[model samples]
Target: MLEIFPVYITPFEQERLIRVYLPKNYNKENKRYPVLYMHDGQNVFRDNDAIGGKSLELENYLDEIGLEVIVVGIDQNSEDRKNEYCPWVSGEYSKKILGYTSSEGGKGTEYIDFIVNELKPFIDNKYLTLKDRTAMAGISLGGLISTFAACRYPHIFTRVAAVSSAFYRNQEELEKLLKSSDLSSIEDFYLDCGTKEASGEALISKEFVASNNSIYEILREKISNVKFEIINDAEHNYFFFRERFPKILSFLVSAK
Candidate 1:
């Protein structure tokens, strides 16, 4: 079953829609389940509500597989998405690669703080959740934030999946942070990037994949259970992300 409600984000000082997907037997049974918090709430489920008329179609997939886990999708602020998802301001190279004249970012710390400090507590109190068994997943910039959150709060997000992660902007900084932080609590991690993240630019696509690999290397050193995959022929979009969801979830579920 799916449920949508507005929740106040104290960091942003506004309420955004939170999409929750409960197990089919959530109401029928009295079992507590692990929760997976995802970014880009609108694009996590139904396609009709997605920005580009595409979504992960996660609801159908989870229901079809009978995965008894809770999913919480936090909507993004379209205008401030870059800032909220990036822990530091975009670097010069990032702007050059993305063709942006201005700079945006540096608010991610506050955003993640809201999730760990306020929103998570609210969700745990309202639902029958296995508070200790929490995970986080996201795509693109969303993936970037998920990785940052894991490094920042490893105890809270034990399992993390970062698909088609765009880490060009803060690659060096994130690598440093991940190395310095204590990631002993992280149980499972899934990181991947497509061979063709950018259409028609082989060099750029290779660089994108390489950047993700750099982070994967750091994670492998700290995390006991980590999976890094280079998806062949995949692109950076919901379609490809949806295609890889099963593998991502499977690893998260089975990895010991």
Candidate 2:
């Protein structure tokens, strides 16, 4: 049985929904399963939160596929989302779009800390989880944040699934992090984007694709366990991401 709970994260100053889908074969007698932490909680399962009436239907699809991994979705605050997604605020593009006055902007580090220190510990205590076999994933801006978390805190998460990541801001900083950071600890990293996403008013720009491809190319060179996919005839929206959710879930679980 799948249990959906509303968790109040004090550090983020918001109440986010956390949905856990327990497979039918889940047993206390057996070993614990891995966990995948996903962002954009509202758009993951239902259509009401997406553009059209068609939803991702992730839970139903995963259930049919007989995957036994637990999924935790964290909702993003619309106003603070951009700031929380990007790592550094000193970049020109970040300052223009995010409107951060100070050189150090965005509470991304704090948000990740909240997830790693507060939320993960609580979930670990409450559920049967394989601590080492953990992953983080998201789409668009959320995808950007997931990638940042993976690069910054490689010890906390072993796998990452960044779908259509918005990498318009702080390209040099991200490159520095990738170069200096210890990526050898990362087990798996997945990057995917739609070709048609280039033409959209979805807050995506040329810089976005450039940065995304740059990061993808760099990761391909540095990380051995990295996978990249580009979906054709697809745009930057929930529909495309919904279609790709199954593949992402399969990849995450199969890596275990």
Candidate 3:
């Protein structure tokens, strides 16, 4: 089942669409299900709503696997992608991380606050959810924010996924933040990217993908349950992410 509603992001002073997915038997069953909060709501379910009309087909896949986790897809503001996705100042970050000129950013924390304090409460109140079985996952800058949320507020988001995160921008800041974070409450953490994204002179020079791999290693060393992966011949795109969605969900919706 699918439900769409408007969520007002108070920090950004904007309203966005939030798509919620429930199992077919949700109304009939009394069991509370685990929830996976995903970023880029538009690209999550329907191809009509995705970039290049490439939907994740998540519902079908979950059904095929007989998994019943609730999925909440949260939309993002495309115009301020860099600003809202960045958890730190862009200048202090690498210069060409955005594939363009340098930028001035650092509003990610504020964006996360809205998700944690506002949207979460709404979802929790509306759905029969397993409060302790909550996770946050996203792609690109969305991935960056998901990882940030996991680090900053593990009590609220116990599991996290940074799928092809935009790490090139704030590598140092991210490393410092994760190293200093309180992740005692986090249970499962997942970090991954396609081989194509990790390749090339741009991402292999100890700054982009290599550094991301290092971050995964660091997190795995520091945290109890962490998984890192590299997809063979995959690229940074919606189709690839859609294909990986099932595996990602499988990792997250474990014994909880």
What's the number of clashes in each of the models? 0, 0, 0
TM-score of each: 0.96, 0.87, 0.92
Error at 53, model 3, angstroms: 1.3
The list of candidate 3 runs beyond 4 A from truth reads 91-93, 96-101, 198-207
Candidate 3, 6-84: lDDT as tens digits: 9889988889999999988889989999999998888888888886788787867766676888999987677877788
Off by over 4 Å in 2: 27-29, 49-54, 93-105, 198-207
Worst lDDT run of 10 residues, candidate 2, spans 201-210
Off by over 4 Å in 1: 92-96, 99-102
lDDT of 2: 0.75
Ranking by TM-score: 1, 3, 2
Better of 1 and 3 by lDDT: 1
Best candidate, TM-score = 1
Ranking by lDDT: 1, 3, 2
User: What is the TM-score of candidate 2?
Assistant: 0.87
Candidate 3 lDDT trough over 10 residues, lowest sum? 198-207
Point out the higher-scoring one by TM-score: 1 or 2: 1
